[model samples]
Target: MMNRILLSVSGVLLLLVGTATLLQPHAFFATEGITLGNDPGLLSEIRAPGGLLIGCAIAILLGAFRQSMTQTPLILSAIVYGSFGLSRLLSMGLDGLPSSSLIAAAVVELAIGGLCVVFLLRLKPV
Candidate 1:
């Protein structure tokens, strides 16, 4: 119930972000405070992550609907979000605090990851 809603909402957010990245990498990068220099490989690099994230978003949305049949995708979602948050934490330790927008992103990543973990725990044996 609540878990499913949470998963679906998170999935929707991921889907929107992923889609935006795929369609408008420059705009996405700008919002993230990144500047894609005039490197030949830059677009390729951007598109690669876009494709991967789109795939992940799809899997997460599917998992939201089929929570009983497939916990694996939800598990992967937790891992993905956790990895992003943990990596940001590591960066904070190594590079000091980032700008406020990036800090906000880090917080959102951590909160979403934590929510996913809590939902996983509440899942009953079926």
Candidate 2:
């Protein structure tokens, strides 16, 4: 169904991004034109959220195959994507514009989050 497809796609994206961040923080950030210096504490801080994002991705992926567990993941998807997208927008306002790639990422995040909201609304009460 559409929900499964959405979750699957979203989960995979989160998984890949999280994995890349956790395993290759410098390389990952470089894509966004961020030059991370050799600071252990900073690297640690940056890597921490990668694990959390991976956890969210796992939960979202679970909902794709589990009929009884769709609702929670839908909510998670909306929260995760919505927050990321909104935060990026806020940064754009406060810190000024970033790279075009980052702007595109924000748009994608918002679109996915919006889809999750739509799917959540369509769910029947249990």
Candidate 3:
């Protein structure tokens, strides 16, 4: 179903991105034209969220195949994506424009998050 597809896609993306961010912070941010320094503290800070993302990805992916556990993941998806997208927009306003790739990421995040919300709304109560 559409819900499964959405969760699968989002979860996979989160997993990949989180893995890359956790393992190769420099290379991953480089795609966004960011140059990370060789500071251990900074790298740790950057990597922490990556781990969280991976955790969320696992949960979201699980929800895809579990009919009785749909609602929680939908809520998580909405919050995660919506917050990321909204935060990016906020950054654009506060820090000015970033790379085109980042802008595209924001848009995609918003779209995915919005879709999660739509699917959540359509779910029938048990």
Candidate 4:
């Protein structure tokens, strides 16, 4: 149903992004028009969140398959994506517009967060 679709899409997207960011931080930033110079410290910071994202992605996928376990991941999805969207909004307010890719990402994050909220509302606790 809609819940499965949301989880599947979010999980796959997060998994791919997490893996890419973890494995190739420089390349990932390059795509975003940012040069992640050869700073070990900066790379470490990026990789840290990337690992968490990978874990979240796995949880989402598991929830998608195990209907009884969907609640937690759906809640997580709402929190994480909502936070991302809000952060992006804050950044825009403070620093002005970023690249097109970043703006697009913000839009997607907001939309996904909204979808999570809607799905969670519709879902009945087991």
lDDT of 1 at 119: 76
Ranking by lDDT: 2, 3, 4, 1
Residue runs of model 3 more than 4 Å from their true location after superposition: none
Clashes of each: 0, 0, 0, 0
Candidate scoring better on lDDT of 2 and 3: 2
Say which prediction, candidate 1 or candidate 4, comes out ahead on TM-score: 4
**Whose lDDT is higher: candidate 1's or candidate 4's?**
4
Question: Model 1 — which ten-residue stretch has the worst lDDT?
Answer: 67-76
TM-score of 3: 0.97
Tens-digit lDDT track for model 2 on 5-120?
A: 99999999999999998989999999988999989999999999999999999999999999899999999999999999999999999999999999999999999999999999
lDDT by residue (tens digit), candidate 1, 4-114: 776787788778877887788888889868888667587887778777778888888887788564466667778877888899999999999988888888888788888
Off by over 4 Å in 1: none
lDDT of each: 0.79, 0.96, 0.94, 0.90
Clashes of 4: 0
Q: Give per-residue CA lDDT, model 4, range 6-98, as digits (tens).
A: 998989888988998899888988987889888899889999999998999999989888888888889888888889889999999999999
Q: Score every model by TM-score.
A: 0.87, 0.98, 0.97, 0.96
The TM-score, computed over Cα atoms with residue i paired to residue i, of candidate 4 is 0.96
Quality of model 4 by C-alpha lDDT: 0.90
Q: Name the best candidate (by TM-score).
A: 2
**Number of the top candidate by lDDT?**
2
lDDT of 2: 0.96
